[model samples]
Target chain A: MVIEKIKESRFTPDVFDITTFGTAFADHMLLSWYKDGKWSEPIIKPYGKLDFTPAISVGHYGQGIFEGMKAYKGETGDVYLFRPDKNLERLNKSAERLDMPQIPEEIFMDGLKALIDLDRQWVPSTYGMSLYLRPVMFATEEAITARSSNEYLFAILTAVAPNYYNKPLSVKVADRYSRAANGGVGFAKAAGNYAGSFYPTHLAREEGYDQVIWTDDATHTFIEEAGTMNVFVRINDKLITAPTSERILDGVTRRSMIELAKAEGIDVEVRKVTVEEMHTAHKNGQLKEVFGVGTAVVVNNYVAVGYASERLELEDLPETESYGKILKKKLVDLQMGISEDPFGWRLKVEENLVEA
Target chain B: MVIEKIKESRFTPDVFDITTFGTAFADHMLLSWYKDGKWSEPIIKPYGKLDFTPAISVGHYGQGIFEGMKAYKGETGDVYLFRPDKNLERLNKSAERLDMPQIPEEIFMDGLKALIDLDRQWVPSTYGMSLYLRPVMFATEEAITARSSNEYLFAILTAVAPNYYNKPLSVKVADRYSRAANGGVGFAKAAGNYAGSFYPTHLAREEGYDQVIWTDDATHTFIEEAGTMNVFVRINDKLITAPTSERILDGVTRRSMIELAKAEGIDVEVRKVTVEEMHTAHKNGQLKEVFGVGTAVVVNNYVAVGYASERLELEDLPETESYGKILKKKLVDLQMGISEDPFGWRLKVEENLVEA
Candidate 1:
């Protein structure tokens, strides 16, 4: 029988209990501070709300960065992190964009593993459920100089979730507004990038769409990622997705899909894709499927896309959201150490973590 | 004597009295929600913590907007707001970009006035000091969806003694990065627009400069605002600023400066000014002064600039910085109702506002 420890997570947990959000915290969270021109030694402590100011640059100015990953429950109850290095790498990229000092990759990954190991049992056994991990960084400085803050705060939280997507999505291709430009933060998953899209995405939803697929700013011709996911467009016999730029997020799932496609000997074209090309292909019976891939949903298949006065309903693709099911199964198996580690992905969670 | 209100803000007064960041607050805060497809009635209630999910659309998607303004204390203890209608108008424009419903200008302005009138003692009177008002709106819906949130929270707060600038600035004409693009939300003062520039601004600061004058995204030719303030460049004799675009924030101070310039017969030209033109003028001594005008600091004059690798020393034009100084004094006098209201810009506070 699994037993829960009474004391706080001192080093690691003898047992774990499942919970959602940041409510159920591991005993130890990795923290490091930078001040007077240098970063300090990292410390691990209990999860709780760190003191924050309303004037904290991150709170008001939106100088915040966050990364989300999941720890999965295998049949043997071993927790595992899928492509954690990618999340850490992306977090650093975001930190750089926000003028935040980046935590070394080794420290970032090491911190994540330590936190997960201490809270491994929080990983749910439900097929779709997992422990959602969030690593966040923000300017903790009280000054409102409208310049880069000198001090910052970084934190990690966990949430147990069944799925991010409710069902198959129906999105709209934004033909007028743009999420980012050539020299914007669209490439980084910065806090402000997400906040800017709120009003537009609200408008798109009012029009009865799930989300808006943002395009290039100058000309809304090239297709970009849906607000939450990098897009994958499958035409007949070929998979084509827009190549990322400074205005698009560098999604880890996007890279993984490319590797999976290449391994399957499928031709994957990474280039600019125009909406007109897809509309033409749809009319010519060449458009096969369009879906989204991200850490949240793995693959959220799209059934429809509304653009410029017409709704493109993709029928005969999969009555059910297909790619998500197939890819998710493969992804989970690969993450849980039960599948052929073809890509050499997945970091196994330590089974017996001894607390001091 | 001012009486302290109890349990009014979400925080205790001591939080503000002793905190290093914006962790403290006054008792009461305004709450206005947008639900049932429209904005709800505005309420002033206790300021408190808002419970939120990490996956909240605002947290992930960045569905947020904010406005910055201030209340000034006159020599006679009367309170005044400086052209607050402009902030309301800009907030609406930002709301439209994010697809959030607009709060009628009267309602917004009324709410701000009521808040200040109720807490007039919070308004400090130190020179170069006043209560800095921050009105912000954010997505509050809890879920993992890509579209905008159905619910939102709009509130206002104030900070005292914000010394926004400390020294003369060294600016760089943004050569590689752009703040906003054509047909983008640049003019709206949307939260994300500022978020995107933090890193690039940091990069500029690291290069021994204070801020970067963002250029157009399509072509990095025309000079836009200095991210936070509108750029006013004096070429020998004339005042030149870039014409506003969809990506350039239409600063209230920028417009007011134009009006003030026209009143003074300064021969202001609101058109595209290139980095090359600036370089050429600097080499020939045609460049006189470069300063920024905004709510904070009022005026931040630059003494130098770097274009690619060439640096321009603009200290010779001592006259342009003086233009900002004189204009700042004139604007302050007008706002406080101590000077001529040639433009009818001041909105005087209602008498006995605290009686209610």
Candidate 2:
């Protein structure tokens, strides 16, 4: 591995804001090239522009995939990553679906740990703040053919993320626009999946909704995802979410939350939740809460859902009485190294991984 | 517009092969930038590499769209483009669906004409050859957030294309995988739509098939597309194809073929085509021919279709009796300037478009 450190530090965690969460980055980034069926030596260099041909495959064919993760700074000044292995595993799964090459475990793990350790100061020590990590891979071959490229680029970027104090959202249930098909790349974190949702999400925002709750493409009858996150609904003290399928992403935070909720003696059901059922539950005064879970925002509670011509507002609950709030606190505490991690989800960053 | 002419020419059309069709390029390419709520001056520059950040929105979120076109060299050394206006219109439609900025008609038309005229020497005069044009647009902003980019890049690239003599394809009818869904971006020429089909097509290739015939996402009950092309079926003396919908691409060549076939007094039906109906037609010896139409290949005949352990071989028809062959010859003749165009689809290139 080659290490090209930045000449000067640009680590300004104090000024980091949520609005520009991913705009600001750490001083260093990790890059690797795939060519001739093998990966080149990984390099950690200054975070800056790259030189490539405009004809690169990803620009025209969209063969790109990415993963989202974060490293938390504990009160003891130690940096830790939560479920980095899961992110890596999901990245390879996305690569397989997009017909791109798989990244080796050593390269992913060693490169990530080394990069994070090198820029450990960027991991903000402020309460409820952490460093957001973006691991992305894209086809780099300069060709115009509608096929997979022989060359690829894998990169990792880090940014200081602000504390997310998300307000309850008003979401629109999709009746026309579809996010993913039954046999599609939705399960994989493919770049195209996210881009395809932007126009629809824009429309939802125009309708005075914070985000869109994507439903099945075939009939638009059941909820699949809420924007880019996995959605969960609580009705009469029972939590239910759509089962992970080819049309739904298998989110790390979603699975963790499911386990955490089950551990707390809450009834958790992993099954398809239909829009009609939610509307009926709301009408019967049984719908308690609805929320989305993802790496960026651990939990975003939804206050209202718009289906057809009706806007069903959920009951407002205090933080102490809200399951979403309770679960997010428990998850955040474990991630920040303030609580016991019975699931072994946290991996402490070793400062010795890189040479001083 | 600024013109950065190449110091030397690399017009080697004689040795150009079909396998390296899009790999080689013309002398120059057209580039335009979109920033600050408007487009910058377009430039015609020498074909080369570009400088960009790996954090470009397209590399992470896949906000990319493209169009395929061809410039034919006439017998008298004149250049002609087949329906360039249609391509530009479709490109903007694709842009709108992807939440991208709409490309103005003048920029698209003027830039294309100037670029083709400047590289007119590269247009092959071979009997069955032409110059392939790729107009692609992508999000170029240096950001990692999953939203539409504030900046974009639009480029036009030209390549020497050899004669396409496609053999009869053996396709596998999809019962599991789907290409698009209702209210999706399938009708637009979005980049992600193509990448999502690579894995399924690779699987079909492994099963000794040339391509996979995509079906509807709901139940896979209706055939939608054959590989990346619009599919057609001839049941006895009638030509049938699926209508343009949110789940099917609005192919230019597909529409042209339908018009030409109708002009030749052939009955055409634009409706849904089901796999079961095709099987029934084959069993009754009523299925006559199956073909695919697109910008590339013009027309590709299908010899067999595999569906659920049954490989149904289509009846062989001579070129004289094949409707696809007749329509392709008429279209190619009109495009190559060998025949008088009655449909007014050909646009003659004027040498005065660019300065000497």
Candidate 1 lDDT, tens digit per residue, A1-356? 11233364432332234232333444445666667766666555655345433344554566667886888887877777888888888889877876778877655776677667766766776565677787777665655445667886655566555567667888899887777877877788787776667666777788999788888877788899986799988778678888888888898888888887777576889988899888888889877788888887778888898878898988645433344345556666676667877887778877544364
TM-score for chain A, candidates 1 onward in order: 0.89, 0.97
What TM-score does each of the candidates earn? 0.85, 0.98
Q: What lDDT tens digits, residue by residue, belong to model 1 across residues B53-125?
A: 3334454556567777878877788888888988988888888887777877756887788878876776655
Q: What TM-score quantifies how close candidate 2 is to the native fold?
A: 0.98
> Of all true interface contacts, what fraction is found in model 2?
0.74
Q: Which ten residues in a row have the lowest lDDT in candidate 1 chain B?
A: B12-21
Q: On a 0 to 1 DockQ scale, where is model 1?
A: 0.35
Candidate that scores best on lDDT: 2
